[model samples]
Target: MDPNEHSNRLSTEFISLVEKINTLSNRTRSSEQPFLGALEQWRIESQQTLDSFCNEKRQTFINSRLEELNRLRTNVEELACVQDVTQQNTNSIKTSIDRIEQDINKIQFNFRPLLIDEHLIVRRSQDLLPFPPSNQAIELTDSSYAVLAGNKQHLLVHREPTLCLLDRQLTIIKETSWPLDDISDICWSSVLNRFIVINSQYVFILDERTMVLEQCLTSDTVNWIRGTCSDTKLYLSTEGIGSSIFEYTLMPSIVLLKEWKSPVTCAHNEWIEDLKFHNDFLGLVIGRCKNNAVCFELRSTVTLNCLWSIQLEEVCSMYATRCCPMLNHQWIVVAFRNPRIFHISSGGKLISADKKCRSPSNICQIGSNLLAIWDQKCIYLQNLCCII
Candidate 1:
């Protein structure tokens, strides 16, 4: 009985020791797992602090660089603004200098005055021959020495035609008499080298050098004649019954090439006072109907046609009409018998109207900036500045 009991007790004690060793092993494993977890948490926290410090350093560097760039941009903008202002001031100074120079030049030029003087040296009564004795004394034609006058009063000057030449002082240099009748108007033809005398029905062209008759043309009563050397054409204005007006042209061969009736018609017995050729196409005809200035144009085939006509406001009678070329042919100055001057375009548009002289009989260009206006008693030299 004793042996069996001891063995059983020993086996029980051994079992208890083995169970205690297993429980201690389990406790150690659980305590070690918690310490390892705490160490891992400390490592993660250190890494986060390092990353935060690095990020703050990077932000400071970026802010410093951005401030430097902004300062550089502001400096550049200020420099550009200063440069622009300097350039503008320089340009303003240059313009002012140029204007001052121009003003000085103008002042210097205007400081001096132009002087003109006329001297009369001689006077003689018989030395000056009167205009040819005719019925109306309508027109005059001149050669180098001879002047042929025509009129409509009685045509007596043609039956006993008188020719006269005068010097600059209007002193008679030569005189001649010819036998003819019924002369109406006279014109000098540079192309034919002749003097043409137009009667009521015929045109007589006399050679200027030889003083011999060259050709004769017969038509209605002629009122005016104008010669053009470029086309070798002579324009003639004829008076018809009543207010009818007709025009004709003579060619180089003294043959009538064109004849046409004017579109402008006057009242009963209205007459054209003067006729002038401004150029090849433009013509001026002054008449008494309402005191109007009639303008005509030579169109295709040199047929005389009316473009536009204007009646002056204050003039009741017109005696002469002439065109003064100016401004490189851009403008024309027309002078009427009532001393009214008008600046008109080539197309018959009136630009300005004013009185220029007192009783101006004839108006002609004497120089680049002057006009010579003559009356029955005196001649005036006028400065035409605004018109030019």
Candidate 2:
């Protein structure tokens, strides 16, 4: 090589090394300091987790006490039935008294003050604006409908002629046309790493990575309305009165696991508009056919037995009701026909409700602290708050 060429090459290499070193210095902020900052953030998050765990335990303890008291009351009531009008044998009376006494003793023990860390509590924000925050929304075509949260920080949306994948910021990543019609609902199957899309008669799976769509012949032919998925199972509900929910396995094929129908699903006159599964429980929205009487029910996914039911208003609508999972096993639901949003506990208790938003049709939590809500024409992104 020429002497001048070698000298220029050495000079270029030296400059490049210095630039790389500067970049590393900027990224690490002197190595140990950046790591220490990250450690502090993790510590704060760990404390938050501990606080939440303590809160849940306190609630569980209270619920157990209430259940035990109910049992004791029932036992006493039965003991009172020892009226001569009703024949109560000596053995039966003794057994009832023993049961009541045992329950009373247990209740007395639990009635004592609990020693726990009650540091974490949720409160409604002072500026609880029920409308879209900062008007951060994306407009869609008139034919667009339905939005669902995917595994990553992305969303699946259906428009008139195509299906689109969007990031948390409501920016479209890709759109494809597989010619689907009457798209009822879409759910992400974490086990399959794909999306399960349901219409009235067919089930489709879309690969989020490739944006490819395909039909699942294994799915049953039914009038499907809305759907939700667990890690291992895909659950779809039907479209009419006395709507039935079908459970299918996520492996091998979308094979049938169990088919739940009314009154196990809901009363004969009620419609199953929306359903979501969180952990071991299933949340259902059942609406009366002829009127606007709607109820949110929590049930066991294993036994399909009702756990608790809470009455709600202005939710059942021309569009199916929505149920999105919230942190700590809570749910955020919407009133589509009217403009109302609700926060509910895992045990079917109303935490709070916002009588704002204009014609809110659907809602889904995008990431941990962000929320995505949509109506007919636009989708809004907002900072999620745990409103009391």
Candidate 3:
């Protein structure tokens, strides 16, 4: 063959070798591209798996915490409910205890009896010649027997007659008789140290030391007499077809001071129940008129006003009146014949009534906290708890 043809064949062989290398390089690059794409897909799948695991763990933790919180809230609500029930029970117990205590106190008071102390004493009178009951004439002296006990020991009067002394209980230090006949009333004067005995028309003053008659008083027929040492005045209630109240002064001899006519025109026909003076300006008078109790007030020596003029529900055969000292003014205490104590104010106002008593003469205040009541045979001391 020719040398040119041989050189051309060699070049063709070299060109074939270069083309085979290029084809091999393209095939290797295609295979490497597929592997790289698969590696990137694996990396993305691994990251997605890690993210799903983390999200599931966080959800589980949140669900557990919520369940715990719900459980704690339920426990707190139950505790509050229990506390409310316990409080209600405590209040109920307290109410029950208070009620029981009140009931016990009431029961104890209802069954309790009056208790007597060392301050109480009793003495009996010695037997003497019994005076006629029809001769109601009696007198008391400053040196005579003490009719009232306690603080009233200073109330001994001077010129009272011996016959006018009622329910006497004394040691009988001395005794004397008066010459006056048909004695109507007797009173003792503490300031004058004498006894004043009243007859139908005259009043005789007798000395306690010498038992001698001192002075005599001339006046109209005196029905009742009350002595007041505060104003140095003597009130004499006169009787006629109509009754009248007269005030007198014993200084410089017995002289009439003032007079108050009866408000009721026919007071003499009616029965006089009681008469008392709360003070110098206030006087109380009670009488029975047509089966009714008429209570009236004498404000001054001239002003007479009827306060409460009403009939009692029960027929009162006898009535007693007393004035009780109060913080504001004097309260009137009235004892009916049926043994009922009625409290009335001096202002014509009724306070309380229907306080039952056993006897008219038995109801008396022993001290601040006790009341002495006579029940016909035995004396009952009552505890004045209401005052306490």
Candidate 4:
């Protein structure tokens, strides 16, 4: 049986017993007449038994999950060791492949010859890394993910008040406070040269260099911001009255551009969780559809037109996604609970999936490094270049 399902059953049974005990206590206390000694004694014994059982069950559930987590970690470490050995031997294999390719080229000199590009190939369970310890670790009250802000800087933000910055070594450098109490997400726009903070109700643009709030954009009819991404133009997802993607031009001032509503044809209710612009021609969005999670391909960012949509495999609980355009292959990572990482191709094909960590919430690629956060506490990093 599923561990989570077993845990849920125990929790439900405990809650029901507690409710019954509370009801019995209330009735006994408010009674007009005193209960018999035998009945009172039975009630006390039953309550004690139930409480003991509840405590036992809770501990059993916690222990079971911890064992499972440790097993997963062991497997990841073994895989990493294997990858390290494989990486060392890659140069020799590449040389052999190069010789074969040259021979094939000579044979097919009269006609167009088939060629293999290393970047186009996909590998399974190739990159799952535990994050290296930070030089100076700082914890925040609100659970959040760390984002690389370029220039060897990292950011860890809380929903309210605090936004902490870290240097190259992951040591706390500086922190900035804001009046906005609820920040849904923050994205550093390399194109716009600013950090855009989404607060559900409005959007704040902070100067990237100065880290000061430069401007605030508001919409009278829109709220419930889900996610945001930017190319030359800013793209925002809203789960307000209707789940939709809004496009706006940031230059000069924030001006409404185009809007695309969530597809009602989707088999399940949709909550557009993440919006990402792959380039001017392509964009990607991850969200739910019925019992499955799905990714939609927006062909045109300007018109917000979806060219195709693919349902992700083994995703019972949808979480986060990251697009790697630097690799030129547009490999996207679709992360879900059981904390698996599914690598989807540009054509919406599932290349591979890996159970990387305990609970992966978000993923991002900075240069050659792929970083992910799990269980609201741990961060994992792996270099994609090595796998490629």
Off by over 4 Å in 2: 1-132, 218-221, 385-388
- Expressed as tens digits, the lDDT of each residue in 139-207 for candidate 2 is 888877665555558888776678888887788999888475677788888888888877778888899
* Strongest candidate by TM-score: 2
Which of the predicted structures, 1 or 4, would earn the higher TM-score when compared with the native? 4
Q: Give each model a TM-score.
A: 0.42, 0.65, 0.42, 0.56
Clashes by residue pair, model 4: 268-290
lDDT of 3 by residue, 112-197 (tens): 45464544332211111121122121233434321211112211111234532112222233435645444443444444556565
**lDDT score for residue 92 of model 4:** 52
Q: Candidate 2: give its CA RMSD in angstroms.
A: 22.8
lDDT of 1 at 231: 41
Residue-wise C-alpha lDDT for candidate 4, range 308-376, written one tens digit per residue:
666665564534444333333445554655566565555666666666545555555543343423235
User: All candidates: CA RMSD in angstroms?
Assistant: 46.7, 22.8, 49.5, 27.2
The CA lDDT of each predicted structure is: 0.46, 0.76, 0.45, 0.56
TM-score-based ranking, best first?
2, 4, 1, 3
What is the full ranking by lDDT, best candidate first?
Answer: 2, 4, 1, 3
